[model samples]
Target: MFAFYDLETTGTSPAFDQPLQFAAILTDNDLNEAERVDIRCRLAPHILPAPWALAVTGISPDQLVDPDLPSWFEFSHQISDLIKRWAPATWAGYNTLAFDEEFLRQSFYQNLHPNLYQTQFANNDRLDLMKVIYAVRDREPDALKWPLDDLGRESFKLDRLAPENGFANHDAHDALGDVEATIHIASVIRKHAPAVWDQCLLNRDKHEVDRLLQSGHPVCLIERFGAAQPRSYFGVFAGTNPQNNNSVAFLDLDLCDASIIDANDQDLAKAVAASPKLIRTIAINKAPNVFPVANPRSAHGSLAQLVSAHPEFHQRVGQALANRYADKEPAQHVEQLIYDRFYNAGDKRVLEDFEVADWRDRAQIVAQLDDLRLKQLGMRLIFSNAPEFAPKKYRSAASAAIRDRWLTKEPSTPWTTKAIVEKQLHEIVCGEVLNMDQICALQDFYHARISEIDI
Candidate 1:
């Protein structure tokens, strides 16, 4: 059983923030509801709403006095009791783990003793609904990608599927209101994305992602709008290095088998795929964004091509093109270009190349991007709904091109940025570096994207 939580707080951090109100939805499995609760405490002077938080949650300073619960101490006791009794192994909320959990913790710490709520929850199972949703939506359709608030009047109903369903038109920003909403979303997920649900089950068991990948099971990589394009990059696990065997191999190092010279985050790997257990063995690591995962599956061997050719784009204006003119016929390029757009894989500026005399021919190229292709490609490009905050899937065919030039041991020019970035990212994610040949392939990759990017 997973207890879904959402907290409305006075501020933002667990160490510094305080939870003014709270909500929760207990589910046995799938969307099956087990329990529901909503509580609001007396609003304190210092706990007054911050303007930005108020506007986002639609909760206000005055509402705190309205939804009176049994008592502060009593309810705190009640919360502890509920958690101990149900003891849900996983608790998830949209951005709640980071924002809600911290604030709730700090609030409890300030109000209660060191023992009451803090001790009971420090070991409690936790999940981040926002992270999961973002992951799923990254592969979703463009229309269905954004949250309801972002869409504003779109068909997606935030309230209908949320606290309204559990608390019956109760306050939205209150802790309990948000918790109910979180559970509702889980129900929606059971219906909309079964694969993610399955992954959740694995998560409950604390399954390792590397093991899942090595299982050789078909990973959907499905995107929104029913578009799917699949490719497999199996780690060649042969030779003397038993550690790296069955893992991604890089230029000279076997990521799975390579020694962790200096690293911090284990899961956010670099060029190869190795267990975080291995990463913990080394010390050269930094934060997640700085490290970036480097899985063979994550990177493109062809990245170096794009970086070298980026400057050469000016020269291609007159030279005979290859992809577009395949024996003077256009077939796969159009399909490929459309596939790259939703993923943000293709370069937007490249559309200028489609500027030919015949508009009909250009229109035909546009047709190849049909909805299905976009969904598949979008899934590959986006790993999470919040791409900037979270790691993305596709490296924009452009990044792969850049990677090739950077790894040549030459002083980095504009061309080397991609490879350096790729090497760093690959190390962060997979805990390995790029292969020499793969690094060299970036130059060609540059030309390839130039040919296919845009219309």
Candidate 2:
């Protein structure tokens, strides 16, 4: 089973923004639809929608706070129940691994569920179609209809790709419309390039990845970035480095490109950290975003070429990796546990107890937590679910910052005021940014809007 999901949110910042709508499509192994869910909730009082986001999504404050809509708590519970029912299945989406996944995790946390279980369970895994699309383009460019932006760069945005590729996307920003487009795109890939699709699906299994990494051979890696397109490279599983217990680092074959490979150990150590080459590291317990290099010839030549060409390549890479973080300060306890994937039995009970506790009891529970990581995490939960209950003395600087940001008021833009509109019109006439006829039309529209205002 594969669960394809999408979210429409108030803004881009996952830490501060909240979801307004959610859509999910459940399909069998072959991409046949089995179930679909579309949900919307009344906007929480604490959330303020961004103006640009509102323009793109076309969801007004009036619409979001409609009395007929479900409450956020009820809506989140429904989403949690649906995901739990479909557990032990692969969760696939375009650009979701980085964006939607975080939103969903935060939602679960705010709702008081074990936040990370959906994506972290042994039987569950994740696949990002955006990454898969990058891989497909590398192998077979003609397999799918690719879109290019105005600058002629390849584009992977769902809205643009949908209409170009013959998928219906009537509601471009609607959660359900995006979900349909994702499913359609997945189906097209499976039909045109079965090999790419199959391997991507196969790699979702953690055990398969473990076996491949344990082989100590070179493999193609596809990594996604939140701000840019996906990048692929040839790398080897450079077993656990000095990062953490579950840390896994990849040795980039390109790092041996004559510079560091020939340098002495001392120089190599500093060079590796400074090198622009990517040394991909991930948590071993988490689902890997990389796939096996399908065609060794086209990728980074043969594995033998990477090995024998530089005899000391392996040793040099190890030296660089070992010294990379030798003197760096460690992460905070809460962040370290998140990186280490160290949730245990006690933590589970703590989460359950924290969720159901009243504000006073919740504060008491947070105070009593012995584990520094759990205590920090518990304070965050308190701030999210019961902010009024959080003790002033225990609140961290970071927590205070988030609270300040969420409560801060934004001033209205100049374009929204009549005084600014008249000034802008004068500037436009004098500056010649627009013609006289265009300025006249704009003034006419402004007057008409003003006349229609109830005030």
Candidate 3:
């Protein structure tokens, strides 16, 4: 089974932005639809939608704050329940691993849901169709009609790719429309390039990916760096990151030196850190576009064998990978601290209670949480959803935070601010070609949002 899902969000920052719509379809192994859901919610009080994002998605201000829609808190519960009901399936989407997955994870986190990684746990796995498409394009170029953008470059955007490949009504930015288009493209690949599709499904499981990488065999890794064309490299399992099992190191056989395996710790670390890297890191959990190398060259096999024989070298590589982020600053915002630590069992139980409690009692349940981050987030959630239920201090503090977030002049802040939206609206009106109606809609959204800010 598979769940093809898509999210239409307010902005790109997963830590700060929120999802406005979540649309998904449960499909059989062959991409036959079984069940579907389309969920939407009113905007959170602290969120100011990006003018450009609203323009792109054709979402108006009235739609964002519709009185009839469920609150964001209720919407999160509905999404969580749907996922639980459709468990043990491969959750998939177009470019979901890079974007939608993060948003979904953050949504669960902010809502104080017990399981932040619902998609990856409980026999559930994930597949990013965009990543699979990249592999298919590299290995089976004629499998589908590849569309080119206006600049004459190969286009992989779902809107363009789906229509070019025979999907007649490709709704570009709508969440549910994109989900159906994704399933159509997946069906094409499944039919035309079954081998590629099977390999992608097999690699969706991190355990399977680990086994393959550790089998002392050469594998083909397909990756696209920036705007460059997708390319395939013969890679061998070099090591696994000591700190995170999900992150594994693979030596690019095309660029590696056999002698580097015997280098000292400092030299090997430098080699791992070098640009145009000899070692490429792969996030196994991301459904990396890795496939077995057919008719491997003798030299490639020999290099892979040498790397496998040296366990000490693997340790050093893992250490080097771990050291790469040793100097990085810790996350300051609560949103960015999602992965800092897992909740204790006590907090998890309380969170389970928090979900069922009435809005008036949720504040008391928040006090029972052991994790400070969860407590803070829980208070904010209460203030956003039902202010009268929140403690007076929390309500006052949340209001002040919203004011500073919206009215701040800081240019580098991650969240969308009123001034930033104003500037973006001006740029869109001046530079981008837009009809007068579209222009007015954007302006109306901006003015309405600004007027609501108490400051």
Candidate 4:
């Protein structure tokens, strides 16, 4: 059995406030409501929600000031009784995994009924519908209409969807009225969209199960483009995050929520190790792309510095840089120049693969990077891949370049590469297939010249 639930709160913190109103819809197989409940209550000292909460929910303080105030504690008891009687496998709400369950648990704790959090009652029995829609369904922006009070978004806005679906929400702050709206929408979706229904149920324990199946499990492999961008949470998607959050990592590991488990949680560590997607935050530029030229470049600081240090490859790097000036060229000329200057210092394979214009732009960046590298000041990173390659800061020029190359939405040339790199072109391509974002990463990777940091 599954329960579709919604709660309106007097405040954001469940630890501080009780539900002003709530709705729960019980369903078995189809839209046939095995059971449904909607409850509202007047405010009291125990549930003295802050003034801001009342204003946000649009529920009047006068509404709860009545002498015949409803007892929410008793109402919560009714809910516990229903759960005991029904023994539902799961209950779902939009963002319920993150927001609702925490609020409910806090309410239970404050009311001296802490065990209400456990499913059967045990821990982690609630499903989050918001995650379900994102993982399985296409996240096209315009799919939804603008909501009354807020901008309509695909990920976490229940208000955005409710109005379009016919159960328009009047207040974000009222728990019972919110419930009435929640249950109505859940009922409508269960009757109409079974795919989203099943997806909501499955997301209670797993993330991206359906989308993974649909795409044959394509993981977003990362490569950083510039130094200013830091390792973002998006790094979690590919593997263990690069952010200095808990300060623990192994030779291999998986990535999960830092807030949910301890750093020493070996079980969680093992789980990460066993996964195929080795999530790791990658730097785009040589160093963090700290703007304003105050910092030294990390990837390829300067040709003069590099040449002065190595001295032997000076002629070759100069030649590669000069190739940018060449009007028309053979693939060999490009390869030879890359071999001379950028071969050992950074991954300059992209220079050999990009169109003339991009190649020229890269040469300029490379020259700039070499200057930074010469100074040995690295760029700063801001973002990490949490199942997606989100950089700390996306350099507009580089991002546009990447988007154009992979999305192919703009005019571009079929940039040719040297012979050795293209060998076995027809072989079945291994490594997980690239996502739209990952494809951009590949383009960024080829173009970016960065020295691998050994940490």
Candidate 5:
């Protein structure tokens, strides 16, 4: 199963930002649609969207506040239910793992759902079209006609790429429109480069990762940046991730050399952790765009030569990583655990229960759970699912806890007050920065709420 999805949010900060609209197209392995979901939620009472974000989405304050629209909490439940119904599917979209996945995780966390398991459990995994594009560009530039931005650099933005490739992306920023575009792009990739697509598609299975690491060959490791273009590195299997058995470690062969094997335990540990000094590891759940090195770059030649000549290189690298993370505490943060490959039997049972439980019963059951980790998880669920049902003090404390975790203070109170509305209205008309389309959208927004507010 593959669920191609996209989201339009209040801003870029996943912790502080909230999704205003959610959309997905559920499909089988062949790319035939199974179902489609598109939802728009009333802006959360506490969220104050960035002006540029609002302008891009063209979602007015009036539309967000309309009684006809579902509340954020209600909409979150719908999103969660739909996602659960399509569980264990590969979640693919343009830049989704880096952006939309975070929004979805926070939504589940804030809505009392077991946010952790949904993306990782049942062999579920994720793929990024953006990374795929970069990999193809590097390996076979002629495989697909890559689009370029105004500056003549490769442009992977969905809106631009869709039209360039004959995919219809109506209303670029609209959640459903973007989902359609993503699915179209993915379909084309599957058609033109099935081998590359299959290779890059991540698998949550630990054995699969182990097999890759044990292969003793360099693989293409790809990473994409939000601001910069994608970069690819040649990496070789080094060892098992010390923290997660399900994850295999890799040494950036391009950055390492023969001198590594002579290093002591302490020196090797320090070297593994240091950037540009050699080794890097990622979990199966958070795997990147990786493929077999079919056409190695010139820079990869040196590492390839070294590995071909040195039989003991990997063994030494493995020992170094083990020494580095030996006594370190396990990561406690959700972000850190996204890449976690290992989950004990008890953890698996908890996740299974979470999946099978009736949505209404989850909060209460979690609240009464005894395990410290389970207790912490349940508290988040209770606070997100039904704050009114929780003790008032508990609710306040929960909110404070999330705020501290996000490292954000609440924005100014009464965000929709007359002054703010008037200021937005003025920005629509008199502001020098906004383009005509944005100004027009903002003006229409102001006109829509003329009867409700003085602004």
Candidate 6:
């Protein structure tokens, strides 16, 4: 089974911004649709919608605060339920692993959903069609018609790519429309490049990827760096990260020599961190574009065999991986702390219960939570959903904080503040090619939003 999904969000920061829309199509193994979901939610009161984002998506002011739509909390529950209902399937989307997956994880985390990794847990896997497209472009260039951007460069944007390949009436940015187009593209891949499709499916399982990488054989790794075209390298697994098994180091045989095994600790660490890297760090869980090298280079094969025999070298590489990020600062925001630690089993159960509990009982449930982050998030949810049920002090403080957050003029703040939105609206009006009516409406929306902040 495959679940092709897409999201239309207020902004790009998965930590601060929230999803305003989520659309998905559930398909069988052959990519035939089984069911679909299109959901939208009213904006969280603390969020100031990015004016450019609103303009780009064509989401009107009325939609942001729709009285008929569910709160973001309810919207999270609905999507979480859908994920649970459609378990044991490959969750896929165009560029989802890079963008939508983080948003989904953050959404679930902020809304007190018990499992932040719902797509990866419970027999579920993930596939990013965009990543698959990169692999197909490298291995099966004749499989699909590739589109080019205005600069005549190869374009992978869904809006252009789908139409280039014969998906008529592509809806560009709308969530459901993008989902349908993604499904069409997937169908094309399966039909024209069955081998590439099958390889992608096999790589979706991290364990399978781990096994292949550890098999002491040369593999072809397809990757794109910055604006460069995708390139293939003959690599062998150097080591796995001691701190995170999902991150594995692959040595590009074409770039580094076998003598790397004899390097000292400091030298090995430097080599791992070098620019035009001697080692490529891959997120095994992100469905890395790695495949069996069909025609292995004799020299590369010899290097792989030499590196495979040196177990001590692999250990040193793992040590290098562990120390790579040891000096980085810890994240300060609650949103950034989603991966700081996993929820305890006790708190997880309480959260599960909190979801189904009545509003009146939710405050008590929040108090029962052992995790401080959950308690804070749960209290905020209660204050937002049913303020009268919360204690007066918390209600007052939360309201004041919301006001301060909106009215804050700190230029370095991560979220979309009122000041930021005002500047963005000014830029859009002056620079964008919109008519007078549209400009007036945007200004009206901005003022209306500001008036509600109560600062």
Candidate with the larger TM-score of 1 and 6: 6
Backbone clash count for every predicted candidate, in the order shown: 64, 0, 0, 68, 0, 0
lDDT of 1 by residue, 307-376 (tens): 2233232122112111122354333422223212232324222222222213334333333443444333
Candidate 5 segments whose C-alpha is farther than 4 A from its true place: 202-206, 224-231, 265-270, 273-277, 294-455
Off by over 4 Å in 2: 67-73, 223-232, 242-247, 254-272, 282-344, 354-403, 406-455
TM-scores for every candidate against the unseen true structure: 0.41, 0.72, 0.97, 0.41, 0.72, 0.97
lDDT of 1 at 380: 24
**Which 10-residue window of candidate 2 scores lowest in summed lDDT?**
407-416
Q: Write the per-residue lDDT of candidate 4 for residues 1-455, one digit (tens) a residue.
A: 66777777755655435676677777765545677777666653323343334434555545554546465555555666666766745666666655777666654433324253544354325655554334323322233332443333232356555666576544554454454455655566555555545544543442333232122122222122222211212121122122321121111112333322223334433343344422222222111111111232332223213223432232222232233334655433111221122222332332222112332243333333332321111111101102122323433433343333333332322321212112211121243333345334333332331111100
Model 1 misplaced regions, further than 4 Å: 44-75, 111-124, 140-177, 205-455
Candidate 3 least-lDDT 10 residues: 446-455
Q: How does candidate 3 score on lDDT?
A: 0.89
Which is better, 2 or 6, measured by TM-score?
6
lDDT of 2 by residue, 326-391 (tens): 787865323333434545677667767866777679778767555566676566656655667876
In model 5, the clashing pairs are: none
For candidate 6, the per-residue lDDT at 328 reads: 89
lDDT of every predicted structure (CA atoms): 0.39, 0.66, 0.89, 0.39, 0.67, 0.89
lDDT of 5 at 11: 78
Whichever of 1 and 5 has more TM-score, that candidate is: 5
